[model samples]
Target: MEFSVSDLAVARGGLCVLEGVSFTLAPGAALILRGPNGIGKTTLLRTLAGLQPALAGRIGLPPEAMAYAAHADGLKATLTVTENLRFWAAIYGTGGVEAAITRMNLAALRDRMAANLSAGQKRRLGLARLLVSGRPVWMLDEPTVSLDAASVALFAEVVRGHLAAGGSALMATHIDLGLAEAQVLDLTPFRAKGQGQATARGFDEAFA
Candidate 1:
């Protein structure tokens, strides 16, 4: 399976957010979208995931072949951790709920309420849902937002494993994730010419 965006444009409040954005992601590959804040990285990911309407261009993916994890954890505040997973598993049509919970180191908090978990814990739970969903493409926005160093490492490992298993990912992150062969797309160059400037160097500089 593959995901591609062609000449994409998105506007919000009558202002252009992204224009002429294009990329193709293949199985076993990943791309990191980087830029200054408000450059439309999150909007691009959301448009690709079909969560937002595209003003122009196209996003191609198989039916139900993609899964998206937004900045929000989207967890049920009133449900236990296990209950939350079970609910998502049913939506994803997967039966390995227990295995996923274990993989995320959430076994100890199985019966704990999701509302009571820390931010990092909630993010981990969100990541764990990807494993249980069995989707071929993952679109993650700030997957490591509140994660600690160890949790970030764990997330990197999981991403590596996903690529090794022929899955693809599109991620937006402010911090570096040590993944060999990962492609970086710097969106700063495409930002409005005179609006503001990105202090960081280009993608090549950042990756090199």
Candidate 2:
């Protein structure tokens, strides 16, 4: 499926930070969002994923069609690697838990509890959730955090496989995972001018 955003506006801490943002992500493609911190990448992604409403503009794709992965690993502390994947698989009504575990090199630690896993291991497990989601569109926020060089390469291969299978990924990150084919969208130009401080709770509340 093709995903698009046009003239989009989003707010954080009740303040408009991004406006006139536009982009299209086609099947089997990837788009990297580039911008400094506090530029509303997370806010825009949250709006697109349906966690929050867009202040203005349009999202061409339904939120249910996309699977979102945030910087924090959304894992159950008591659940093992395999258990976590199975839980997500059940909710998404998707199978292939075993394949996802293997693809992420988690077979060795499949039985280990999430709380027992290292930071990098937890990150790997979190990303594996994207595969079992079975959604064509992936909205990832800094998906490479806590990963070593070798592990980064491994995740890159997994992403390649997803694109090969006709899926799409939209990521906001600073690291280059060697995805030279993925297009970059710099968010600086679309920044909202003279935005106010976000006093209300939102993504930018910390900056208030």
Candidate 3:
């Protein structure tokens, strides 16, 4: 599915962070968001994922066609590695656990409980979720966190495969995922004016 955002205004905790943000991603393509911390990168991703509403403008693409991966792994500690992938596959109606395990190089740890995995292992499992989501548009936040060089390479490979299969992705990260062809959207220029301004106390009472 193709994705587009037009003149979007994003807010977090009642504070507007980004405004007039716009971009598009066609199938077989990717878009990378680059910015420093506290600059609305995560907020923009979350807004696109429907975790929060956009303050203004529009996000094109059906909510069902989007799959979001937050910074957290969202794994059940008691479940095995394969079990985790299998569970998501069942939910998404996409059976690719074995393939995903192989893709993420988790076959050796397939039987290990999620709680026992290292930080890098947990991050890999989190990334494997995209494979089973069965959704064409991926919204990822800091996907390469905690990965080593080899694992990062594996991630790049799978992402390429996704694009090749007519899937698109929007990723927000400071580090490069090695997506050489992906379009970059820098959020710095769109930062909202007076983003952190606090409302005056007397104004509320006067209005009331």
Give Cα-based local distance difference scores for all models.
Answer: 0.81, 0.90, 0.86
RMSD over all Cα atoms, model 1: 6.8
Of 2 and 3, the candidate ahead on TM-score is 2
Which whole-number lDDT from 0 to 100 does residue 148 have in model 1? 95
- Cα deviation of 119, candidate 2, in Å: 0.7
lDDT of 1 by residue, 18-82 (tens): 67788899999989999888787877776777765666788888659998988888799899989
Return whichever of 1 and 3 wins on TM-score. Answer: 3
Write model 3 residue lDDT over 154-195, tens digit each, in one string: 998999999989999899877677776699988999999887
Ordered list by TM-score, greatest first: 2, 3, 1
Residue 130 error for model 2, in Å?
A: 0.7
Per-residue error (Å), model 2, residue 203: 10
Model 2 lDDT tens row, 94-167: 99999999999999999999999999999999999998999999999989999999889999999999999999
Candidate 3 local distance difference test against the native: 0.86
Most accurate candidate by TM-score = 2
Which residue segments of model 2 deviate by more than 4 Å? 197-208
